[model samples]
Target chain A: MSTLEITDLHVSVNTEDGPKPILNGVTLTIKDGETHAIMGPNGSGKSTLAYSIAGHPKYTVTGGTVTLDGEDVLAMSVDERARAGLFLAMQYPVEVPGVSVSNFLRTAKTAIDGESPKLRTWVKDVNNALQALDLDPTFASRSVNEGFSGGEKKRHEIAQLELLDPKVAVLDETDSGLDIDALKIVSEGVNRFASKGNKGVLLITHYTRVLRYIKPDFVHVFVAGRIAEQGGAELADQLEAEGYDKYTSALR
Target chain B: MTVTDVARESVASALEQAPVVSHLNPLPSYDLADHPVPTGREEVWRFTPIKRLRGILDGEPSDARLEWDTSVPEGIEISTITAEQARELGELPPNERPAALAVARSGGAALIDVPAELAPGEPLVIRLTGASVDDLVWGHLVFRIGNHADVTIVLLHSGSARYCATTSFLVGDGARVNVVSLQDWADDAVHLGRDAIRVGRDASVKHTSVSFGGDVVRMHANVEYAAPGGEAELLGLYFADAGQHLEHRLFADHNQPRTKSNVAYKGALQGQGAHTVWIGNVLIRKVAEGIETYEENRNLVLTDGCQADSVPNLEIETGEIAGAGHASATARLDDEQLFYLRSRGVSDVEARRLVLHGFFNDLIRKVGVPSLEGRLTQTVEVELAKTVLAGVPLGASLILPVEEVAD
Candidate 1:
């Protein structure tokens, strides 16, 4: 079983002032077939944790240990972490100019699988993945994330998640900016992946509306660079009824 | 106020409100005396590294000739004629020093004549290959397209030489023409060339200049309408390696009413001392009302110590024009785009190559030569191999693995 364990991670981002610490003494774990949703308000260092796990050059890990299936994730480069089965669906995926989505997916698939995918099967898989996300089969020909609407960008990410099939996926605010119908479509796509029962998902969002569709096994109250509290799925309902005011007010 | 209201009081008052013409483009002349050798201080020659030109501006006489290979159809003619015959046959005169030298020293012009109503799906290919880098060659060519004709011309230059040439296109009424000039010269070759076109009434012309392999390549493409309703599109693409200097100058003169012109050029520079320049100018005279013109230049500096100078100048005399605009930009490889691609499991090498290919893919598609597209793509890949793929020491990840051959 694939397991991702982050132990007491301390991260800082370099700013005009200095190294501004964003994540402090944060620890979490997601085991096989488990979906953990980390609910936090703005400035909670949730997205920072996601990018750090994926080894973005913008963030520095002062003290931490991230292991994926007993392999040192922190020691690997960005692409190596990806090959080692770590995926980060970005909050704002940047637009890649003139690189068609079809070509991009194929390149990614080749890099992940260490060889070219079978053309006939690969094309069919791409069309099927995009179709399941309500994206047109023609969408495969477009440039990656270029000129995509808000819902389309998120759905395109989900399509990539399905096609890439990483061991652990860190979805950073995938539900934000999505309409109700698009949210349902994206949630169903996630549920289909979760149902496979071989992958681990760490869903980071500010809303409990998505948890209603894809049930999370656990919910952690994240605030101000650390986890304020932790509980089972019921904690999501409590946070929906009562926002993170208590935690932020305590920090204040 | 009768016609007497327009009477001149001295010559200065009558000329006070006249449209201003650019000094960058000197008046065209058949006499070589009118075109002077520049000292690198002239506005048109300021960006050019004059020393690297290797005395091409000196206009010395040379007897060398480039080997010419042509594919002329049955209805077309390829023959040699005197410069006097060329000018008598309505060829645009040279407007610059290098071009004037080319016409003055080339001895004669190669005339390619296409008959009226001759529409060929196949391109007319002219391949000129030089023998040595020490060879000093001058060339003059006049392509005459008759009324209502449609033609695509491909001019290919290769090998090594210090070559200066002038070419003219006399397009007749209602004709359509596409001319692609590919400068794939040797690394030591220096070329100074100019293309001047006179578009007849209702005619359309598309001229594309692509320079990939040259040490010092300076080219100019000038267009002026012979009558109203004519249109011109000037497109250019170039790549400059270390110590290479590539320059392109474009001039669109709207001498007739209701005309249109569009100019776009894209270039990429890699390695130290790699420099590129794009100068685009459009002059709309007072008579040229209701015209539309736009010019854009984009440069991608792929490495350190590379310079790209892009200048777009528009001299519009009439405010009644439909549109007039220009854009110029030069940028380095984007880090965010690289990270985005690498986050998808793409290796550093592949990610960089993909980003660059994406940068040029849109402009390459606009070349409109389907047969040459694959070749151009391959050439771009080869150019990338000299820098990014050759292991410029961008970490250990930039180098390709054993199994990662060309995909």
Candidate 2:
């Protein structure tokens, strides 16, 4: 089974003031078939952890070690990280003009799998994935995420997660802008992916609503770039009853 | 009778209903001796680097050797006629000095005439290959399409030479014509040409210019309607590499009522000293009521040290026109798009290649010539390799399947 390990990850981003630290000495570990929920308020460095693990050039890893199944994850390029079984469903999916969704999906699959997929079966798979997400078949011909609504963008991300089938999927705030119907559809897609056994999922969100659908195995409260508390699934229910004020006030 | 012939008969009868305007003036002519040499001060010649004209504007003609090969379809006639013969065939007067000089020094014009009501099944192709001679060369060509005829003309230019040519089209009533001019000259070649088209009543003309080669290439394409209910579509595609200057200027004058014009041009620039200029002008005269016009120009800059200048101008003296609009844009590669592609396991180099191909795909499809479309796609690929993809390592898998490798 694949294991993603992060040790004392110190991440910083360049801002107008200077290189401001976002993630300070944060540590987390997730193994295959485990769903880890990271619940944090705004400005708690939750998304920074996801971007850093995905090897985004914008986030600098000053003092940290990230390993995927004992392989150096921090040293890989963004595309290499993706090929090495890491996937990121960005909070705001970028609009890629001129690249059809079908082409993008096939290219990513080919690149990650190291071979071109069988056309007949691949087309069927893509259609099925899009159908599961409630996206029309014609959506495959349009430019990726270009002119798509907020809910459509999230649905497309889930569709990608299903098609790519990465070892570890880091979804950052995927439920923020989605409506109730879209939220349920997206959660169902994620559930289907997680049901495929031996897949790791790191769901970063500020609400416990998505947890009700996906049913995380573990919950961690993040505050000020560090994990303040950790528990089993019951902690999520407690946080929903209360709020992040206790955690933020304790950090202050 | 053919449908176009029937339409022409009806349009001829309806032409009497078009209003005559006394205020619509003709374009300024430089054929007279009093028209002073452009010091880069005139509005029309302001953007042109006059010093690089190689004395073509000073009445000095080059003795360069140019080889001509043409494939004429059946029922079409081609002949070499003197300038006087061409003028007698309704060739309009030159509006600029370069065209005037070409007409004055060419001594003769290559004329292609299509008879009335006869449509050729194949395109009329002409290949003009220039030798490495430094002397300036002047050429004049005329295409005459008779009433209700449909034709396609492909003008291909290649090799190296300092050349200037003036091409004129006389389209008859209700005729449909598509003229594609491709400038694929070798490096160090300088070219200046003017194409003037006169569209007849109820007729439509599609004029396209594709520029990819040469050190300095400039073309002026102007259109004027001979009668009402005419239509013109001006399309251009260009790629400018290092140390090259490519300029395309277009003007569509709507002097008749119920006329329409659409102009779209797209270009890409890369490397140092690469420059491209697009100037689109549309004038709707007071008498040209119910006219519709739209002009758009877009440029993609692939690298630093390159400049793309796009100017779209619409001068309308009539408020009764259906629609009139113009747009221009020049942009570099989108960083977000690059990141999105890269995040999907596409390498940096492959991502860029895809973006560049997509930038030119829409315009290339609009060209509407199957054979020409394939060649342009290959040309764009080669251009990308030469400039932007020069140093990047293109992965072996990106080009070929793993099974194809010998190892």
Candidate 3:
């Protein structure tokens, strides 16, 4: 019952040089029960699309309209968009030094649900979610992302995605830096989240190794801030073999 | 068997014969001639707002008194004695003018004795409440924690007063002690406080100074080892509001080999004219080899018109040491951290509350007063509500619940 629609999205990020344009007139849509993978090269603006959709203060929306179920997502604040069912699994999760994972998750859940979760059930849920990601129960007491290894940080993000249970999730490079075991665990967590049959997944990645496990229904080839081509899941395998050189050479 | 027991034989005879006092200190002396009124140009007085002292620097005697409310645990003795008796009990001499003035002007001193190996079940609470800002009180207190004894002592200040105190903690060998002096005065109050600690062999002492109120409060905690294997942890926390000055100074003198000293202080400033100063000075004498020491200070700026000065100093005379280092940082709330919290559905206001509270949570945990932790968190919330969270009620739904710090 969730539909995230992006129309002609344009984004520019602030740098010492200037507001350099990173995303240019990109359009895409993610509907319920569908997994869409946006695969591209290193500088393809794939992560930019994810962060922009999540309302990060770093990115400026020069142009475009993003809506969730016909409501203007562009008009909402970051937390408001989150409450409206848009979740972004950041590629580089920031470290919060003194906030424990359980505390953070409960706080976020309270904010999103507009009511505090029952403590007993919430603690059990958190432990279960962490265990599913191959994380220890004691990990709930650790400060968020602080001193976490690459695998731990990514796994924690997937844990949040499962617990927050938002309608539409835009994961930006959640599979990077994860080994095979971690990749499988994180993919399973994402699959579990998307398997609800009512949630939309916009899985953005640089490689097709993760796509093989998650099985995306649609694939968009991203190049120079725009989608150069579109196809089914087989396009991910093709990109993995042939790479994005063919897509970038035409523009060069 | 302990040095304290031997010192009980004769303080003058023991100290005069020890020949262990480091030349670098040069500040602790019983003579009033050794301490002079500062022109605010001296290293110790430069960062202080001397003019705001209102003649306290003159060291004039005052008969004013702060009403005391005490919770005396079992096996502890609190008695009034002369400052001369305190000195005879082996308490270190006053270092600076305020402390020397406190010892000179106060007619008598309060002495609390925790007998050898005695463990108190509850914290010995000494709550002092001043009647008005007009009261200029001089305080002298001597605390003697005996060998192998474990104890926690809390000294809380509130209401209004110009109070100057020279307190001493003489911890005996193998003793474990946690001393917390909380400066929660009224807005009009000014306080000049000092704590001089002599940590015995293998003893561990944790002294915390927390300043959240007062017009001008400058507090100092200085430590020196009585013998080797002594460990001292000095902690400080402060919050300065508009037009308020809160200063904390620490000096750790390692005159004995194989000793350790660690100092960590965190502060927050908000509103116009809010200022805080932290000076951490560690002096390692030539004989003090194989010592480990580190000092750190962090400040969070919550508003535009606030100033936080953090200075860390380490003077090592000997090259043969285990380790020595210092760190300092002053910054506003991190933007990326805010974005991460907000993207998780925490509102802007709540995210800020979490970050600011989180900034102090770790240090409060280190404060080690379990009963006072909750109250400290609430006090921080009230301080925040003054500016950054203005118009937000203490019970507002926007204020996130303070969680138990796990670190």
Candidate 4:
């Protein structure tokens, strides 16, 4: 079984004024067959944590370390970290006009698996994944994320997560910009993937609406780059009703 | 050592060899010397480096051809156009000759001509090999697209050679033609070439050019939307390495109303002194009301010493045109774009190639010829790998070597 462990990880971005801390110190771990949710308000470093863990160049690791199954993940390059069984579903996936989503997903799968998949099996797998996401097969012909509606983009990410099937998945604000129908469909796809054997998920979001559909095994509150509170499903419900007003005041 | 002296000498030599030559001939009237170095003064040479072109003016033209590999598609017929054949077709009225013609004499060169109205299954391929030689050599290709016809032409240059070339094309009324040019020369050659096209009424012309080699190269293309309702599209992509300089000058004239012309050129430069330049000049004449014209040039400088310069100019004499504008931007690779690809398990080298391929995808996919576009993509990816991977920060691990990265 694989596990993604973040040990007191802190991140900062090199701005014109110098390094400004984004994630103060985020520590969490998600083991195989588990889905963990990190809920926080705007600027609470939720997305920063997602990007930092995914090895995005803009997010610098100021301190601490991220490890995957005993390997130092933070020391690995972005793609290396990814190939080591990790994935991040970006909130604002870029519109790559020349590459089709099918092409991108297959290429990613090959990179992770170190070889091309059997043609018929790969086709069937891709079709099944797209169907699960309620996407047309024609989406294979369209450029990756180009001109896709907000809902379509989210579904496309889920489609990738389903097709690639990484050991660990980091979904960064995947629930944003999605309608209720889209959210339900997207959640269903996530649920299906989460049920797969030996898979881990780090679900980052600000709202509890998504948690209602794909229940997270653990819920953590992120504030100023660190996890300030840890609890279970009821914690998400409490935040949804009471909000982060209490957490913000306590952090200050 | 100015361009004028060289042009004058070339023209004088041609005159001495021609039996019907006259001292008062107005056909070669555009004197390279009399015209001030095109310093963004002319609308056509605006986006290109006016000063850097000075290096090409004094350099000796040679007939040198290197022995690098050449790739040409199979099945397409290839033939050289003879002087006799050109004479039989009649002279291209004085007004139709491009300014580059003053240096291109008819007898010393060979021309590739694709038959009118013939659509071959594969692209007509022309491979020009050059090596270091003292004498100047000229090559001309005349492509005549007959009414309602369509075809594709691929031109590849490889080897160590220093020479200048001229390509002239004419599209008959209502004809459509697509031409793709790829110049993948040895890293140690000097190259200069010019393209001049004439579009007839209701004719459509599409041209794509990719440059990936040579020590210094300057290419100029002139398109005349000579007839009403004619459409012309000129797209180009180039990658330059250290000590290399690439320049492009484009001219589009909307000579009639309801005509359209679009130009977009993008380049990536890396290494020390890798300089790239783009100059676009468009003219919307008084009679060209309702003409639609757009020009855009974007560049990516991936290294500290690399440089890119772009200049766009629009000469609109009337406000009747529906659209006329130009856009030019130069920036480094987008970190976000790279991160997005890398996060998908694509190694740094592969990730960069994917992003670059995507950056040029809009144009390559538009080439409309799958095999040809695929080959060009490979050619550019190879060139980009040499410098892009080398520039990566130390201690940074990459998934594949620059050469191993594929699209």
Residues B280-321 of candidate 3: C-alpha lDDT, one tens digit per residue: 989887778999999999998877778999988888767899
lDDT per residue as tens, model 1, A171-242: 999999999999999999999988888799999998999998989999999998889999999999999999
Residue A57: error of model 2 in Å? Answer: 3.1
Candidate 1's TM-score reads 0.93
Clashes of each: 0, 1, 0, 17
Computed on C-alphas against the true complex, the DockQ of each candidate is: 0.44, 0.25, 0.46, 0.34
TM-score of 2: 0.85
- The CAPRI class of candidate 2 is acceptable
How many clashes in candidate 2?
1
Give lDDT tens digits, candidate 1, residues B83-201.
Answer: 99998988777878999999999999999999988998888999999998889999999999999999999999999999999999999999999999999999999999999999989
- B-chain TM-score for every candidate: 0.91, 0.87, 0.90, 0.76
Query: What does the lDDT read for residue B343 in candidate 4?
Result: 84
What would the DockQ be for model 4? 0.34
What does fnat come to for each candidate?
A: 0.48, 0.36, 0.52, 0.52
Off by over 4 Å in 1: B1-20, B393-407
Whole-model alpha-carbon lDDT for candidate 1: 0.88
After superposition, the stretches of candidate 2 with alpha carbons farther than 4 Å from their true spots are A42-44, A206-208, A222-224, A238-252, B1-27, B30-35, B62-65, B81-92, B115-121, B146-149, B172-175, B319-322, B392-407
